[model samples]
Target: MMDKNQSKRFIQFAAECQSSALYEHLSLHIAEDPELLELSSYAQKGQPMPNLIFGAVHYLLLNGKEHSLKNFYPSLVNQPETEGVFTYFKDFCLAHREEIIPILERKLVQTNEVRRCAYLYPSFCYIYDKVKKPLALIEIGTSSGLQLLWDQFSYSYGTGITYGNPRGRVHITSEIKGDSTPLLLDTAPPVSVRIGVDLHVNDVSNPEDKQWLQALIWPEHHERRELFARASQCVQETPIQLIEGDGVALLSQLSDQISTDSLICVFHTHVANQIPKEAKKRLTETIQEIGSTRDIVHLYNNMNDGDLHLDYVHNGKTYNHTIGATEGRGRWFEWNIVD
Candidate 1:
């Protein structure tokens, strides 16, 4: 087995592989494969990868497919055959490269989804600090309510294993970087408000939606499957205010209704990528206009748009945390400049 340093570098190598040869090869392979063609029937230029494969993969990976991904040998590359499981996953990617491209597209290639994925933990940390009491958070583009349950639980990072360690009943040592994390009303109590918005909100509890979520999972990645299952379960029991509407339009409307003292945090992840340039501009303008009057704070992800430099455009100081599936996944930053 590889040592910690080697494993860390391996992750870095994986990060670099994201947009280079691997990406190009997968794209070309998928374009020619019939399975990919069938899977991508509903995928337009802007739409996320079709629902069928995504849901199926999500279920398989999370519920029962950990062994396949964790213990398989990679088929593409021959070098660095450090362990049995890693090699199996590499083989899975290479052998079924064509069939699995769409699944990867949905998870990593989707720009909007990438943005939302990064925002998950940062937004959680931001709210925890800002709201002293239990929060009533409304998340935009919450594919499943995994992010919303971030504060409701805790996590333990171990060698080659990560599991669901609940917060109240179990004491898990986790460090959150922020001024303050919102204290729950009761150790066992749920947050005050939990809602999700998606153009097509995946009903995580529904068997069909679960299937689509499974398909969304990349082949042979079981850790994520575990995460998704826990998250899906959270959404199923929690009463979420999920609605089908344009996020920008809905947020504009929601802004008007939220009381000043209610701690309104308008958040969106991975959803902005679907928004047109004109729509994005309008949304920003709307937020700026709204911020002029009310005490509102937005904890959204930084877009790759050259025009909007959210990295340093803060009126106040900014705090940045380097985050992603791998190290240096750009900066996961937050700051309350409006205050």
Candidate 2:
């Protein structure tokens, strides 16, 4: 079990890596403040404490909470106040202790980063190439299910060429790192069905849910905020089947519902880290069991390590490989798929 100080330090390093100066600075201060640390203790087990606390504060601010802390947020103000933010942040949290605690206790750090679709686009293409079947996407921890709509969005990997939906409303751009390039399809592969299962499925159409998701985005990430808004609009417009339950437990039952003609592509990104070790083992076993019957592909990361992995069972043979590494936010990815 990670203590409060360790969690705070983890967030501090993570924020620095993600280039969120605001969070990096705040986390440093929060680590030293016993009161704020105590308040953060309200977060649920396995939840990222920094994200929960910051998101709670952002949710309140977006809901029109009046506070000097608002001045420090780039998402709220044109010229955000840079200095003495910790004092204002501490004051705001203390003042709204009652309101913040409920959010901290209830909400999970479930960010549906649309940009992650950059890598998903190619991975799905690879699946389609191998099996030549429409994909049945079952996303575990699909908060708001925006990523399930990857086919409906356009993408660019720092190249002049455009891919995916040409007329896509949400155009995602990512940097292609490393020397090797993965397969890129001129168009998205056909998706037969999209099913998202989560402990608490967030409905993007709901005002409160939408606000909470928006709050999850870092205050300085203007591009991410805009992408989220666009993707949320897309999610509301699209029809996706969302189930409320433990995704790992429901995998087999859900797989039975999909037509055998479609390739079963079970996937989750940046979500498995929160799952219990035992549950993670069960999830892998379940996927293997499902694979024994028919062709299935599992695309995931943060299970054994942070690198993106592609494990597919094709024609009674199982092949597993590390596809490559990816940025936390999908800002860039290295496509190292060998043949």
Candidate 3:
């Protein structure tokens, strides 16, 4: 169990990983109140802390913790099922705060074991058959550009739903009801082109940021890191056009440049939740405007303030909708409008 001293140490270490402004921001909102800080102190000590807590901390650091705390954490800790995990963290924080804090910082910002399960291949395979011909792919939230390798490899799903090699980081295991499966193209189509955009892109080979990416990985799932490393290996050779600016702005630019003669697939994954409401609105509007004539495919979690589902429209009509889940795991429902 973590003691208060330990708790203090962890909080301080976490503070070090972030800038002063970030720490203060989180302290005001999410990490505010003695209990929350206490809980946080403990949570950092857990062997496999709840995803909710880890996600909360990540969000807090990125967004202001205090401003986002109430909305994000809510009363999740009080729930009966979460009591045990809560207690464990509380104790750990109370006991080993100092040791744990540095350890977590090291794990989060300096390791590679956390970079697994790049879930990009599965999503690509899902759309491969729809736009079978040669195409250019653009990805938003392209963290580390691992998905760019989609055009370079193949994947075999554990079940019957296998996709041939030259796979990307995403994978698909969930069953689909549709009669058609992804058709195999002669080749990945020369990437015609591929690019990635993110708020901050981790250099997989960079010692420091590599640790940060590793920290982002869930420790409980050992396979995730392995998968990410494997995908990373392929990405070294893949050509990725990385743009380091706002995705919404980029989409608007691409909307005008896309060639109708060729299919342009603009996609994303499990990243929408991190965007602010206003940003999301702009993104939706951008896509709605662009989808009128182009083929845009986005696979991202709808789990945000207003909606936890993704809505797609083609030619001003709804084409696809689904409740996006983490790591490409969950149910997907769609409605297509035939031209």
Candidate 4:
């Protein structure tokens, strides 16, 4: 992230996060226009607003400006023909500069989509075996706790490989990267407890928050958009408890609260990338310190690994295991099982 050209770096990073014509057009548009470049320059703040370019477009779409970019966005319209049509888009964005600045100023893209659960197969598989029965799951960056109810959503990895609630409205599918897939249980584990900690817990029930969550999704991914809608409904039907605070700071106290009988497992997906390196160091140290008194399992999937990592405290040693490799959107995973 420490680059001389901040604006160029932000645009490149934002382009990678997106997969549709709207974003493609936006990238080309921002790269050429000085006004757009200046607007995107605000993202130099780093972790606070990592992807400011996308945030600006997402805010506009969520705030009833979908008409501005609907023709370019594929998910909203068929084929989405926007050939050489960046002037109007630029004008629309330029007009909404004041509205976008506030969204761009917000801290990070707090996404809580359940589609991410597709990457948790290995983590959950390990927990199901080691924990035996009931699991006390504590997620670090659990945004709205949608992924907290992972077991509730069904999944289809391939024609033969499938799991979770088959009748469930939300369905996520990942392409198999390799032959070595984890031996996942046909059914999800029995959850005795589920709680998540976040700096700002998003309530799916709230209109603005729910809309924001929807906005965070890329415009091309229609399946994910549908899955999100389904998951949001589940949020209203059965609400989850998400504590607000710094997870690394609040983890120890939260871990101590888990009952002795239940197996304590701390986990996070694509979260550590948002925090400082020192904070990540503190989180690991805190987890290991807490392990001294009780048995605890920690799992994390981040950009560094491209797979889920398991840290189990056994015989006073933290045995680390490389579980599996998955796509950014959980499109596929090549599971590497030690056992």
Best by TM-score: 2
How far is 58's C-alpha from truth in model 4 (Å)? Answer: 3.3
The all-Cα superposition gives candidate 1 an RMSD in Å to the true structure of: 9.9
Clashes of 1: 33
* Candidate 2 local lDDT, 225-274, one digit each (tens): 89999988888888899999999999999999989899999999999888
In model 2, how large is the Cα lDDT of residue 70?
97
Top candidate when judged by lDDT against the true structure: 2
Model 2 segments more than 4 A misplaced: 1-18
Q: Which of 1 and 2 is the better model by TM-score?
A: 2
Candidate lDDT scores, in order, read 0.45, 0.90, 0.48, 0.72
Taking all chains together, each candidate's TM-score versus the true structure is: 0.57, 0.96, 0.57, 0.90
Candidate 1 Cα lDDT to native: 0.45
Candidate 4: where are CA atoms >4 Å away? 1-4, 14-18, 48-50, 66-68, 314-317
Q: Which of the two, 3 or 4, has more lDDT?
A: 4
Give lDDT tens digits, candidate 3, residues 1-339.
Answer: 334554454455455434233233343333323554445444433232223345334432333323222222322222223223434433434454454455443332212221212234444444555555445677677767776666555544335534535344434243333323333343444446677777667677775555455445533334555666776666676666777778767887865665665555666655655667898888877777777766666555543532223344433555564432332322332222122
- RMSD after CA superposition, every candidate: 9.9, 1.9, 11.4, 2.9
Model 1 residue 8 lDDT score: 39
> Cα deviation of 277 in candidate 2 (Å)?
1.2
